[model samples]
Target: MVKIDRRWKQVVRENSQSPLFICLGEKHEVHLFETYFKYQLREDARTNDVYLIHYQDFTDPLTYGESLLAEWAEAFKSWPQGTAAWPGVDFTVTTGTDAGRPVAALAELCRLYPHLAEQHIFVQIAPTVVSDFDALRNWISDWGRAVKKGGISKLKLVLTDHHKHQTYKKAADAVRFRIETDLTAMMQHAAEFTNPKKGDPEADYQQQILIASNQLSKGNYNLAVAALEKAVRIARRQKLPEAEVTARLMLAQCLAAEGKTAPAHSEYQLAITAAGEKNLVAAQIHMNYGSFLLSQSEQAKAKTYFSKAVDIAEQIGNDFIAMECTRLLGQLSEGILTGDAEAIRYYERCLEIAREMEPEKRRQSSMPYVAGILLKKYGEKSAAGKILDEEMRTLFGENWIDLTKKPKQMK
Candidate 1:
């Protein structure tokens, strides 16, 4: 083990929970513009709480060492780092090539804190640092002496407006990190919050929702359910009511697909209670529940939910849901409604909406096909023909599809 100096040890103990940053350079120049660095960092700290340690140069090494240690001790004297259940972010941005103790210090930080590999970042804003191959390589390898084995994340190569970082640019890209000339917006994020503020919980919940959505769409039901459980916890902890409703709805759908009826129904009830009827949320949940009921052969119960979906969709003027509910209602009418009038009315309503719909929405798949068959079966050829004509126009160019020449089985 490379023993840390007693001064650095105090810093490690006191400030480990806050993200640690070290600016590396030719010793004097880095500390020369320390004022400007402090100005920019102070502005950033308003949004993020970073425990920044800017390298200071004193006239005497003895005074510099004493002052630096005192500064750290004073800063965290009362603030507890607590037990390291969640070791916070570790970040670094080097401006000059100090291929000495500063580099070795980084190696030590990375070795002791494995989370550094995930959160530690390097921003090459100045040319002198990456101008020398030896210095650049040391940075790329995190000073080539991590006890956990040497490695580093992508180096952010900030180009001068005159584009003087061509060498660094090519090298960074060659190593698989595409160079970014603008680091202002990204600077605060790399130095992200130590706690779960700065919208991290919401961001994590959103990411999980995206993953769960794609997994569900791809029929990976089990994985989707697992992802949704995480999303639900994050949403609840963050006190995000809308996001919780969305996560629970998808969670219920996944459970229903997996045939976990009891749990699926429980999730549905929770979501529906949170999102009362007459809202779009209610419309969506009811439609999903109705589909689940249909899949389980509870057609009578399914129709009730589908009817509720139609009412909510109409109240909110959401034609998309209206179209789905109407189509399903028409299909269910044949088996349960005791008369063909309800079926004809549902099909006619679908056709009316389909006519007003833009061709791109492509409502033809449900309205035109179902309406044509049902109206014709009831010997209402003229009404069915008009709906069929609109379908042909919507699905194909007006002159492309002619129902008259279609085979009997097609009608």
Candidate 2:
């Protein structure tokens, strides 16, 4: 098997159970289609046979699909003499010049070979083949409905275009949850909060916040921001400072995600003011703001806020916040400055905080922190490293993956 790119492997591993994947990217440069085909071949070669179909070869959509059934049937006839049983096969179809017809072909293929839907199949479509964005979007809307209507099995559709527009964004938003387990779970949880209880005046405002969370998980930042804004307005009208602060914090997150940096910063400031300096909510706001700053490449500002948060958390005896802040600081020290002394101190404090917390509140992955410290203080071949590796293997089995290593790419 060949090595696969880290991002590609992460996607595949996380979505192993998902029936579909929609990857939208640049047409000429990204090479998302080719990379995905190679990655899937390497990842699933042991269990399933992989085939690629260039859909442009056939003029008619029905004929394009018929060829696959014919090929699949022929494979069973000329089996190797020593084979134990009939082998299963998966397919990847790519459409270039004839992108308009491939969707029909795919839907027909699914109708004929409903059994093959159980295996992972990939498809690549060239968006430029369409006349305009409207055409492309119409194609996508139709295609999405067909898939949801139980037309395809395991399909990964890669859209290669020179540039992405609103159509691409909408398509990605529609499918992101299927590709990410955490998001799918979050969406499910959010659905429970969608309806307010009868005669509960506060439930409406609370519902907005919960629904906003669902939109955020779906990557619909604009919708999330709008929901949070409505929640904040309701909270302010009710004179509920705590609820307002919570709403504002979420509003800031959505703003930041949408790349509205100035508005995000203002929202964070408003939230902090509302929570007050010594409050636990203030500490949380500081931590969240620090994370935002870190994402924006403001390390010094992030460090200052992290320090403030840790100080407040220590005063309030909130071990969870302290543990989290210290861990973040440790990551920064180790990753950015490579400052072993500071990083080790922060990590040790984090571990101490974790140990002191109640079992239910404690995070179970402290061994990785110790392993990280060992890797920094001593080389991979050192006694500490050997001990850490052996311990990790004992805990997670012999094939445990190393957290520090980058996934290999195909040469």
Name the candidate that leads on lDDT: 2
Q: After superposition, how far is residue 85 of candidate 2 from its true place, in Å?
A: 35
Tens-place lDDT digits, model 1, residues 53-113: 4334323322332333344345545435422322222333343323223333444544565
TM-score of candidate 2 on Cα atoms, chains taken together: 0.45
What's every prediction's RMSD, in angstroms? Answer: 20.3, 15.9
Q: How would you encode candidate 2's per-residue C-alpha lDDT over 349-404 as one tens digit per residue? A: 87577557665555344535555565657666989667756765665556544543
Q: Count the backbone clashes (under 3 Å) in each candidate.
A: 0, 2
Q: How many backbone clashes does candidate 1 have?
A: 0
Q: Candidate 2 regions off by >4 Å?
A: 1-200, 214-223, 277-279, 334-339, 358-367, 378-411
Collision pairs in model 2: 27-161, 117-153
